[model samples]
Target: MSTVKMISLRVKSMKNIQKIVKTMKVVSAAKYAKAKKDLLVARPYGTSTKVFYDKLDLKDPQEQTLLIAITSDRGLCGALHKNVSTKIKEEFAKRPENSKIVCVGEKSRGLLQGQYGKSFLGVADQIGRKPPTFLDASRISNILFTTPYKYTSGKIIFNESKSVVSYLTSVVSVFTLRTLNAAPGLRVYDSLDDDLLQSYLEFSVTSLVFYALKEAAASEQSSRVNAMDQASKTAGNMISELTMVLNKTRQAAITTELIEIISGATAAKKDSGV
Candidate 1:
């Protein structure tokens, strides 16, 4: 009877844990729905920007390439962070050892610091929270185009096959950097004459950045949702098992009491007969 009581107590504690897990699962699912919606909304803007960039015929005058990899600040959303980090690492491995990195998220910061250390340059944690203005984009663009980084010193070789305009557009849109009023150091490309192309480039880059952010956010939410869902399922299963055990314990206690009562009654009857 005492053993049965202990089992019942354990079952009750398990039920409480199950309830908490179920609640968390629902919360995560709700977050996932919101994140997914945001991501879908940003996709069209990103796609349009890419299309505009594809129409441009810009050429690069400089040699070094600046790769900006975007990620998330916090990671509870499963392998989303890991996937982006892995892609960045693989890309980094293909580049020259002197390549510079501009990271956008905390996850990127941590991963880059561990992998490339000093190679990482500017890191912006607030990029996702607020969309960057054109002025900010111009500033970053100026630094990349005009500023003489240590890596590009030796006889810089320009790649004529690659469109510099497209590259710039992709980076800008993907990062969501706002366009500046007075564009500086943008005349390097001979083919870039139309003001509309330049404006489009800026817009595209900003949109791309927004899109990337949305995707990352969605990934995070999805991961959390899946994790919570699994947890909830596990909790439910545990609850069911505990309930069964509890019922069995109660039945055993009742059976033990009944047996004791029956035995005592028989003993008394025999005693009376004697």
Candidate 2:
């Protein structure tokens, strides 16, 4: 019933809230650590696949360019999904107007749907939590091969700039496939033997699909790690704020009790004629 008691209750509530936030922060940090590790392990494989694809001289104009846009199914990862979506959009902008987009995550699908509409081929959910197995890779590869992308031949375009390629190569040389032959109007299918060309096309398409999945997995993990880190930081801040509030409430209660004591003493003195 007392003001002090009410204030104490509030302090207790704040402390409880602070405890929850602290726990959440710890959990997020642990998840982030695991995600970071996953990303590191998969980095090399993704890079090598990309490098191998770059070496093939596919210069045919009639070839359909398939853009496998990778992103997270969820959105708690800071600007990771946004950044990827932006990168995809920029890549799309550079294309010759009829590029096909195959999204790997729900986030990517949702973001690109309004813009690309029917051009969006399909979506794969939860592609980031686990390391992509060959089965997973095969599913994506099959999708690419069976889809209209193969039937419609064109140049394959990567969104990354030259600087990015250079940076990646310098850091992870083994993963770097090779310098991409960016020569415009270069014909690709001409150099291959008939059966080899078909095989190469199939392999190339599969490789691209595999690379995309790998990259998507890496990116998603990285994004989640970053998100968890930020969540941890935000939780820390909330705890701090709650602590301050608890302190303030405690102080207010203490001041109220002192005031009541002083008032009682004054009343006694007046009644005693002192």
Candidate 3:
């Protein structure tokens, strides 16, 4: 009976937990769908922005590098952001004495701040509070171009959403003044003034940044959906096993009671016959 009670309690708790996990899984799927739409809207802009990189490659590469990590404010996405953070650490390790880290979301900021200390260039938390937009991405992109920091190379690290259930932790490069100037087709845009070149850089960076943000968001939700689904299944299996145990234990208890009653009746009959 005690065993039955314990197992029953566990099964009850698991049932409630399964309910919560199932609800969370559904929410994550909805969020993932929304993020996919956002990515579709932003892809063309990112692709068109690449034209700037072709015409204006920078000649001077900076001694220090900048690492930009795209992450999210909320967790429960398994290791999606953690993978990006690990990549950031790997890139930081490769850099020489001078390098800067830029965090796009709360997760990266929290993870990197402890390890990198003062090495962080800045953190953009509020940008990803809602679904990423062109305006938001433009602000972050503008800062990178207008900032006086002489970073030669910049890399954006993110979880690329490959499909509903697949994602890749990937890194992409942002061109510097030197890289853009050395681009293969420099002669075509050579006539354009410095202002035009700056404008191009802004467009390229904004589109790329926005795309990264949306993709990372999509990856975050998708990963959570998958994880929660697996958790729910595991919980359900556990509940079913415990229920079986409870039933068997109940049957055993009832059988023992029946045996005791029959033994008492047999003894009473023997006494009466005497």
Q: Which structure among the candidates has the greatest TM-score?
A: 3
Off by over 4 Å in 2: 1-53, 60-64, 95-97, 149-195
- Give the runs in model 1 whose Cα sits over 4 Å from its true position: 1-21, 57-63, 126-200, 238-274
For residues 1-274, could you state the per-residue lDDT of candidate 3 as single tens digits? Answer: 4677888898999999999999999988888889888888766766666555634554436576888899978887788888999999998888747678888888888888887968877777785457887887776776677767788778889888999889999886786656665566677644776677767666777778988888888888899999999999999999998899999998998999999999999999999997
**10 residues in a row with least lDDT, candidate 2:** 169-178
Provide TM-scores for the models: 0.58, 0.67, 0.84
Each model's C-alpha lDDT?
Answer: 0.54, 0.54, 0.81
The weakest ten consecutive residues by lDDT in model 1 span 155-164
Candidate 3: worst-modelled 10 consecutive residues by lDDT: 51-60
lDDT per residue, candidate 1, 223-272, as tens digits? 65666667667777887887787788788889989999999999999999
Candidate that scores best on lDDT: 3
lDDT by residue for model 2 over 171-264, one digit each (tens)?
1111111112233322442563456644655565555545545544444444445555555566567657656666777787788899999999
Which portions of model 3 show Cα errors greater than 4 Å? 54-62, 127-129, 142-148, 178-184, 252-274
TM-score of candidate 1 to 2 decimals: 0.58
Return the lDDT, model 3, position 271.
Answer: 94
